[model samples]
Target: MSLKKLETLSTKLLLKNPYWEYKLDNYTLPGGQTGEYHYVHTPGAAMVIPVHDDGTLVLVKQFRYLWKKESMEFACGGVKDGDFLSTAKNELSEEAQLAARDLRQVGEFNPFNGATDEICRVYLATGLSKATRERDASEEFEVLRMSVAEFEDLAGKGTIWDGMTLAGWMLARRSVSALLKEKRL
Candidate 1:
C-alpha cells in the first residue's frame, strides 16, 4: 500500500528566525485523510557529550529566555549551514571552549518527534584541550564539570530536565556502554 502526502494543501509560517521556522505542513494522509503537521523547520542540530579522559563530563548552564531561568544542559546547538561533525566541533569550542581529538558520532534522534522534525546528532567527545572561546550575541551560559555517575544521578533525580541534554545523553551513553561491554573503554 502506498500512503503519501498527495499535495501541500497550504504552508503557513508562524515565525521566521535565522535558525528555525515555526510552520504548518498541511497534506493528505495515507488513508486519504486531511492532516497537518505543525513543526519547527530547522537546519537541524548537534550535541556533544564532552567526556574527559577520566569520564567526567563538561556541562553548561544557560539562561533561556523562554524558561526565564538558568537551565542546565549539555553543550549543544543548531547546525547552522554546516555538516554535523563540523557543527559538533564548533559547538564544542563555542559552548565549553574545548576541542576534542576523539569526536565519535554516537547516534541521531528527533528531539520532539510529535511536534518537530528536528533531528539532533549526538557525539561522544574525548581527548579534550582548551580552545579560544567566542559567544554568539544572544548566548549566555556557564560551564560545569562532573562525573558520568554524578550526571546519571542528577538525571535520575530530575535535575536534568532539558530535553536535548537528556536525549543526547541517552544516545551517547548507549554507545559508551557498548564500548565498555566490548572492553574497548
Candidate 2:
C-alpha cells in the first residue's frame, strides 16, 4: 500500500527565522477520507553508532532537559546547511572526542513522526583515532566503552534505558558480527 498526498499549506516566517517554518498537509486515505496533518518545517539531523575496532561500542551519558535526567545515547546532532558528513564528524568529536577512519551509514530514523519533519541519519563510526575533546556548551557527556555481551546484560537488567543508544548498540553489534563472520570486520 502507498500513501498519496493531496494538498499542502505552508506558513513562512517573514522575520527572525525566515527559513524556519511550518507546513500543514492534507492527504487522501485509501477509503476516500481526507485527513489533515501539521508538521514542523525544519532540516534533518544525524546520529552515530561509534564502535571500536574490537567490536566495542562507544556511548555518551548526558543530562536531557525534557526527561529531566541524564540519558545514555549515541552521539547525535543536527545537520547544518550542506554539511551532513561534517555534522556527523563534529557531533562525534564534540560528544565523544573521537574520530573514525571508517564512517558509514547504518540507518536513518524519524525522531518526531507525529508533528516534526526531521530525519536523523544514523552512521557507524569505526577505527577511532586520537582526538581532543571539544564538547558543545550545552552538552556534558561521560563516555563509556562496552562489549556486546555487556550491553545485552545491561539492557536485560534494566540498567540501560535510552532508546537511541540501545538501537545504535544493537545495529552496530549486528553489523560487526556479520562483518566478522564474513572476514570483513
Q: Per model, how many backbone clashes are there?
A: 0, 0
User: Which digits, one per residue and each the tens of the lDDT, describe model 1 over residues 25-86?
Assistant: 89876677888778888889999988776667899888888978777788888888769899
164: Cα error in model 2, Å: 3.1
lDDT of 2 by residue, 1-185 (tens): 86665644434433335334576666666667777776676667778877776777787888889979877777887776856788889888888889999899877767658867777778888789858767668778898888767778878886788766666555566676775566553
Instruction: List the candidate 2 regions with Cα displacement exceeding 4 Å.
Output: 1-4, 12-36, 156-158, 167-173, 180-185
Cα distance off (Å), candidate 1, residue 83: 1.2
Which candidate wins on lDDT? Answer: 1
Model 2 / residue 126 / CA error / Å: 1.2
| TM-score top scorer | 1
Q: Estimate each model's TM-score.
A: 0.86, 0.79
Report the number of backbone clashes for model 1: 0
Displacement of residue 159 (Cα, Å) in model 1 is 1.3
